[model samples]
Target: MHQRNISTRLKRRRAGDPMREFDALPPELRRWLAEASLPWSPRSARRIWRQGLKTGGVDEALRRLESAEVATLKRDRLAQL
Candidate 1:
């Protein structure tokens, strides 16, 4: 079994994207990502992180916004159908 540091795990999850890319993030960003109930793979956390960054640094906030947008789009399209 390969033991890896949490950061390495996180990096892999981000598809090996350099952490320097997210240097603008606060220290809490890593802790928040670690605590989030995402799938065990680093890839899942990376996806959340990417989305969170896109939505301005709050993972849950970004998820909610994305979910709302998706739901709204689905509803609109269904209505058009």
Candidate 2:
């Protein structure tokens, strides 16, 4: 058997049906997700969306998603240094 490469993070640990979860998201959120910089789990994205909805609405949710993606990118770049 071939040796496996070391892992940097966890992968594919889904507890529920990811497709179903994704299908339940708002259409606008789904569109935004298509252009997102990172692989965002449906549950986490929904949590942020709900938070933004509470604070404002759909536009606010999109802003929150963008803000989150930018922050994650910055952290990833710093880790690579």
Q: TM-scores of the models, in the given order? A: 0.30, 0.80
List clash counts for every candidate, in order: 2, 0
Off by over 4 Å in 1: 1-57
For model 2, residues 1-81, the per-residue Cα lDDT tens digits are: 322222223243566887899999999988877667566778888999999999999989889988987786667667767
Q: For residues 1-81, write the lDDT of model 1, one tens digit per residue.
A: 322222212212334445553454455555544443332343444465566677676756457534643464455557667
Each prediction's RMSD over C-alphas, in Å, is: 11.5, 7.6
Error of 1 at 59 (Å): 0.7
Candidate 1 TM-score to native: 0.30
- Top of the candidates by lDDT: 2
